[model samples]
Target: MNILILGSGGREHCLAWKLSQSKKINNIFAIPGNAGIAQIAECTALPINKDNFPSILEFIKNNNIDFTIVGPEAPLVEGITDYLEGNGHAVFGPSKDAAKIEGSKVFTKKFAVRNNIPGAKAYFFKKNDYEKAKEFIEGLDAASYPWVIKADGLASGKGVLICNSRHELLEALKDFFIENLFGKSGEEIIIEEFIEGFELSIMCICDGKRIIPMEPAQDYKRIFDNDKGKNTGGMGSFSPLPFVDNVLQKKILERIIFPTFESLKKEGIIYKGILYGGIIIKDNEPYLLEYNCRFGDPETQVVLPRLDNDLLELLVNAGTGNLGSTELAWSAKKCVCVVIASKGYPETFSKGDIIYGIKDYSNKSDTLVFHAGTSMDKGNIVTNGGRVLNIVSQDKTFNGAIEKNYNKIKNINFDGMQYRNDIARKVAEK
Candidate 1:
């Protein structure tokens, strides 16, 4: 079957890589794919924007694309799945209605409360209610100093901020509501009670009813090491968290994942495709941090490598809502992915710097260099976006996998290249 994937990041590149391993797949194509994805699949200049829906449909018909997978949230929020499904195309994504769980933080926060889902307590504020929001924030107890201000809409994972003092909180609120830093995404804001705990990411395949959870992953969100800098898309990730054993896993599935689906079902939304739960584990209990409608970026770079199943068939089955008796198997090995970004990432940074050593390093066994933001520039690969490449490595042990990746990362370099040195140190040490 010919497969078409949307988006141009590392997650889509990893999806393209995993899907290519399936015998059922004939040819794979990515819309506006990056330099690394072009090595494995046919990269087309086809735009996947909502306005170009007709063009995508035409390409689907002409290319005999048997299935399509969406790798980003923007097109999905614009009703890509609804549009594609209405036109008799099977798509691996949630409908716009279901995608609102990610698109609108205010909607999802209220829905979670109404459904009794376990998550952080949040107070939603509109753009015009800055005073009321300020009053509410000021009234909070002293322990609530560190508040989380989140833009109700998507901001490429940079919309959430953790403030340590009332001064910082007010500044963040000003940035969102007063200064309009996030634009439409900040039109509505959510001030959530900050909770301190290590974060966990769970990606599951859902067919409206049943949810088949994949390996657990932990992603570093901050742009700098030691989690000290502002949040970026993602800095690095590792799969099969050592701390999440069978007991904690069962607790999460029962208390979080299963109930979340049941609540969505009660709302009459039939969710199809990936459902990502960002959780914070405190005192051995998992609390829902947030949700992503699709796969996580660096998380996918690590998690997909551990999958021992035919990803193509599974996604197709999930899209059709038939995923009957299809159990996914995963490798016992551990995986790690360290994102290589342009200097001053998650902010203004120079691009078009020539990158080298990727081709030579990726030739190693159990190692892959998935491109996130790279383009071919005059016969040389150059930095094209904030996060440029994911150096992925797999091994029987997590530490070994991390070491292998770092060893390989040493050889890869570009102008203003930056990456976290402690990708899996916390988990590996524990």
Candidate 2:
């Protein structure tokens, strides 16, 4: 089968890498893929964001591409899945209506509230509410420090700010409303009471009817280790969190995950594709942080490698309603993923820095490198975006899985490559 994947991040690289290993696959293509992906799949230099959809439709028709998978949020928000399938191509992301689950935090808050899903209480605001927002923050002086302020729309993953004090929250809001840190994305805002807990990403495949959920993975979103600094796209992750035991997983499914699907169903939107449930697990109770319409990035690097099932088959079956009878399989091995990010990331970061470790991976059995932001600079691979690569390694033990991989990370070199030192150390410390 011929397959086309959208976006050029680590998630796409992992999906491409995994799908390429499928015995049933004939050919695979990545739209504007990075250097690492070019090694496995046919990297089509099409701008997947804008003009490529029309070209992609024609290419799928001409090449007999059986399936198309979207890897990022932007195209999905533009209804790329609805278009591809409308033009007789199969896509693995949600429709535009379903994509709203991720595209707009305001929309997600409304949907969750309407459906009675458990989450932090939040209030929305427009640009005109700057004064009102100031008053609200001042009133919250009696509450607690570190208020959570978020852009109502998508500003990548860094749009959510966890401010430490009323002064800091006030400053952040000023930059957002006045300095335009996120432009129109911050035109409207959602201020919520901060929820402190361990965050877990639970992703499930929806076939527009039934759902096939995958293993839950935990991602460290803060830029620094020990959960410091601002939120980034994500710094690192690990799979099958020992924290998400059977009891907690069951409760989360019943409280947040099931009700989410029900709400979308009530709207007549059949969510076919990945339903990403971001849960803040605290006090052994799960609170919904957010929902992503597709798979998580670095989390995918760790999780997909442990998938013992045919990925392409699962995606097609999910799109076709055959998933109801199918059961997904996973490897017992523990997977750990560490992201190599550009220096000064989640802020000002330089690009075009030559990265020199794509081929430096050791001869380890369960190791794979998935590129997030890299390009071929006349032959040498170089950084093109903030978080560049996902270094993944697996083992029977979680500690053995991550430690082995992070040691190899030191061998790799780039001008401003920055990564978290403590990935899965929480589990390690335990």
Candidate 3:
């Protein structure tokens, strides 16, 4: 089958890596794909932006692209799925309207509140409504708790603000709204009461009716250990968290996952593709923090390696509206993925630094490297984005997997490459 995968990042790379293993796949094309994806599939520089929708559609029709998978939320938010399916094409992503669950934080928050879905209370505000913002923030400070300020629209993944004082929060608002740092994404904002707990990421596939949950994975987004520093795209991740036992998983499914799908269905939205529910387990309570329309970058890297089913068939089923009695299997091995990034990430960082050692590092040990934020400059792979490669390793034991990945990292090198070292240390400590 001819497949067109959209977006350029580690998540796309991981999907390409896993999907290429399926014999059902014949020809695969990645639009604006990174250098790493170039190894697994034919990488093309096809314009995937909304403005280039006609060209992309024409290419899709002409190439007989049997299926299309969108990797990032940008084009989805811009209605790429709606356009393609409207033209009678099969696209593997949510429609623009369905994507509102992830596109607008305020919208989803209101939905959760209306449905009585367990989550933190939030105060929404428009950019021009400074008085209300200040009033809400002051009330939060008087309550004496850290509140999370989130840009209601998509700002990549760095739009979330966890502030200790009202001053830092108000300053963040000035930078977000007045300075327009996040562009039109900051046009609206929501201040949520910060809930303290371990954050777990749960992704499920929906065929507009049936919801199939994948194995839970936890991703570390902070730049430092113990959840400190600014949130980057993602630092590292591991699959099959030990915290959520069978009972906890059942509760999450019954309370949050099942009700959420029902709510979206009630709204007449065909909730297909991936739905990421970021849940915080506070005092043993699992509360929905936010939703993402597509797969998480580093999280996908770890999760896909554990799948024992044909991913290509599963994705096609999701797009075609029939899951086809599919049941996913997994190995007992735990997978850990560590992201190797540029020195100054979630901020300004230089690119084009030549990465070395990967040439002799493929299929080595339990570690598999998927490239992100990289490009083939002539013949050498060089940095292209903040996080460059997701180095994944697996073992029967969780600690064993973490050990293998960090040890494998020593074999790969690039100038000014930065990576988090504290991944899975919590599990290791016990």
Candidate 4:
């Protein structure tokens, strides 16, 4: 079957790589794919975005693509699935209505309340109601020193800020409401009470009814090591978290995932494709932090590597609502994905620097360098975005996987490359 994936990041590259390995797949394509994806699938250089849906539809038809999978949230939030399905095409993603769970934090918060889904305590405030927001924060005791201030709309993972004090929370609000730091994304805000806990990602395949949960993966969102600094998409990730036992998994499925599915159903929206739960576990209980309509970036880089089944067939069946009869298999090996980013990522950084030492990785066992922000410039691969590449490796043990990944990561270098050295350190120690 001919498949077309949308996006130009490591997640899309991993999906393309997995699909290329499928025996049933005849051809695969990616729109605006990075350099690494080009190695496995036909990378079509198209300016794909929300407004250019018509052009993408034409491309799908011309290429005779049997299935189209969206890898990013932007297009899904912009109603790409509805547009494609309306035009009689097979597409894998949630509708614009269903995507609100990821597109709008305020929407998800309200939905969570209505559905009795477990989550952190939050209060909604619009830009015009700045005084109300300040008053709400002032009302909180000193115990809530670290407050989570989030922009209601998507801001590429930088929308949420953890304020260490009242002064910081006030400053963040001023930036959002007064300074307009995030533009339209910050027009509205959600001041959620901060919950201290270990975070993990739970991705599931939902065929609008039955939900098939994948293995748990924990990602380090902070830009620096030891979980410090601002969030930048994600820094690194690992699968088979030592903390997520059967009890915790069952709680997440029953308390969060099921209600989320039922909530979407109540709204008359059949949520197909991936439903990623950004969860925080505290006191042996799970709390929903956020949701992504599609797959997680660095998390997918690690999770997909541990899959023992054909990814192409699983996604296709889910897209067609035939996933009830299908089952997925996973390898026992632990997987780790360390993100290589520009030196000053999540802030200011340089691009166009020549990257080296990736081509040699093909000879390495169980190691894959999935490109995130890269492009071929005059026969040389160069950095093109903040998070550049994902160094993924798998082994029988989590510590072994982490060791193997970091060893190979040292060989690959760009002018301003940076990565976390202690990825999955806490979990691996246990």
TM per candidate comes to 0.96, 0.94, 0.96, 0.96
lDDT of each: 0.89, 0.86, 0.87, 0.88
Q: CA lDDT of 410 in candidate 1?
A: 87
1-430: candidate 2 lDDT, tens digit per residue: 9988888999998998888878889988878888888887888777766556798787777778888898888888888988887877778989988999998999999889988898999988889989998888888865586678999877887688888888888998998899999987899999998888878898999998887778999888889878898888899999988877799999999999987887788789899999999989879999998999998988898889999998888998887667868887889889999998997797877788988866544323687788888988877888898889888989988888778788778778999789998998778735
> What's the number of clashes in each of the models?
0, 1, 0, 0
* Residue 229 error, candidate 3, Å: 3.1
Off by over 4 Å in 3: 141-143, 360-365
Comparing 1 with 2 on lDDT, the higher-scoring candidate is 1
lDDT of 1 by residue, 1-430 (tens): 9999999999998999899889898999889899888887888887778899989999889999989999999999999999999999999999999999899989888887887778888888899999999998788887767889999998977788888988888889999988999999999999998887878999999988788999889999888889888778899999888888999998888888888888899889999889999888888888888888999998998888889988998899999998888888989888999999997787776689999897543333788889999988898888999999998988888888889889988888899999999998876744
Q: What is the Cα-based lDDT of residue 53 in candidate 2?
A: 78
Off by over 4 Å in 1: 360-364
Listing every candidate in turn, what is its Cα RMSD in Å to the true structure after a full C-alpha superposition? 1.6, 2.1, 1.7, 1.6
Tell me the tens digit of each residue's lDDT in model 3 across 1-430.
Answer: 9899998998998898888888899988889899888887888797788999898898888888899999999899899999999999998889898899999999999999998899998888898898778777766645566888899899877788878887898888887778988888889988888898989998898778788999999999888777788878889999889878998898888889889999999978889999989999988879999999988888888888999988999998998898967888988889998888887787866688999878645544578888889998878999988889888988988789888888888888998898888887777636
True-structure lDDT of candidate 2? 0.86
TM-score of 3: 0.96
Sort by lDDT, top down from the best: 1, 4, 3, 2
Two-way TM-score contest, 2 vs 3, winner: 3
